[model samples]
Target chain A: MTSDATPALDPAVADRLKRDGNGLVAAIIQQHDTREVLMLGWMDDEALRRTLTEGRVTFWSRSRGEYWRKGDTSGNVQHVKGVALDCDGDALLVQVDQVGAACHTGSRTCFDGRDLPIVTDQSVTTDGDPAALEGDARG
Target chain B: MTSDATPALDPAVADRLKRDGNGLVAAIIQQHDTREVLMLGWMDDEALRRTLTEGRVTFWSRSRGEYWRKGDTSGNVQHVKGVALDCDGDALLVQVDQVGAACHTGSRTCFDGRDLPIVTDQSVTTDGDPAALEGDARG
Candidate 1:
């Protein structure tokens, strides 16, 4: 169902989306100019429509059960440049001109190198897999 | 729970994840060296396990109700570099060394600038509210 606050979405584009049981699809947000990925959010029909129509990113908050415009509170808005549907139609790639930090922790991207452990040759090979062996040997 | 075939996952890391009602998390795949985002997928515990253990990206196929190793048939394998959990823990950022095209249609990214229409100033204001008017004025 489209949000009452937004205009109707493109029927062809909307029809292609494969929403999950929760009527939500994963929206991968990317910075338009640099193509750096910022974050991933959930978008229902209403959220998608609002985002497409309003020219800013809107997401369906799973916890709050509401439509959240990205910059409404945090002022870290994602000004949308383009929205693309993947071949599977289950996910979306949203290209946006991001302002400020997209991450809640003040990191530029959610995948910033902090919490992520770098995959080393030792970790994969120690587990006793021949494939890991090949991986180690490749290095 | 970690999969039997893979190495034991850190309990702290696993505990942080907020799985959906269907017990799945959104996994964003990116090219490791170049940092280009490729696609998004869904993963359950087993899928995560297989990805780490097998050194390739594996996702839970919702429609087929099975596990799929990317590039197993397509030859577009994603050799993992690292996996990071978002601060919220509901989403994942998987860094990998992508091989060939990440998209089924041979695009480097699932969201390759094909379907996305560039957002120009004209589209938003024609059918918008005062907020959209403000957005237009901001530009």
Candidate 2:
């Protein structure tokens, strides 16, 4: 875990993370309150900068060669709670306060209907579908 | 997070979650030890059933119309620690003990090489990279 009050991340460490073997490090987004992981994406320097500067998570798209910020299009923005680096300084852990659904689907998170089911109210309901991002919403 | 012995989860809730308009939900995998999200995939009832029964996480591939068991091909499997459904029953939280690298790039986890630069031992090093996963020896 990273120290809460550090001047800034080491410039060298930042450089290394950007160059992980595949030219990118996959970002892991987790919920601050629940400690549940919400989504995963690729991140480059710009995305990391935007995430830190903007207080929202951003990722680099190797295919698009662009920055993909959470909620840029969909309303599912992931708020940054904290950031940590592994002992090897080869990975990142982003604690976020996700707003709205983390997945493109209408569900509140991206991991909807994943490992287990949650009971809501008197009835039991499953999570929403994320495919909606490619469906009518885009249309 | 849901308890380890949560009475098998209600079927009605599972059915509702399985219907995310497209009969799939995004399954986000996070590292139980580091709390870093590793990857994102889709899941169906069968996938969920397999994961629950096998003690490893599995998902359905909407693009391929098949079941995807993480580390099936690479040997980097995600061991389940705990699974939780969000309050709305629209998302899931899976705590896992990840093995090897989660990203296809072959790094230890997906959050590697993500543009997080830091100084270590007076040298700058990157995080996860293609080289990290190129010849991962983990089995």
Off by over 4 Å in 2: A1-53, A56-139, B1-10, B15-18, B115-139
Per-residue lDDT of model 1, residues B41-126, tens digit only: 88987787666655677899877889997898988888876677777878888778888999888888886654543334465333
Tens-digit lDDT track for model 2 on B1-139?
Answer: 7776735534754755623555654465666666666655556666665555556787876547787777889998787655654433434556677888877778765544453322222323234443322221111
DockQ of 1: 0.32
lDDT agreement with native, every candidate: 0.74, 0.56
**iRMSD for every model:** 5.5, 14.5
TM-score against truth, every candidate: 0.80, 0.46
TM-score of chain B of each: 0.77, 0.67
* Best of the candidates, lDDT: 1
Candidate 1 Cα errors over 4 Å, as ranges: A1-6, A113-121, A124-139, B1-8, B118-121, B124-139
lDDT of 1 by residue, A1-139 (tens): 7566636666766788888898999998988668777888999877887777667888999899988877787899998766777888888887788999998888898756434332344563332233443343212
Q: Report iRMS (Å) of candidate 2.
A: 14.5
Candidate 2 docking classification = incorrect
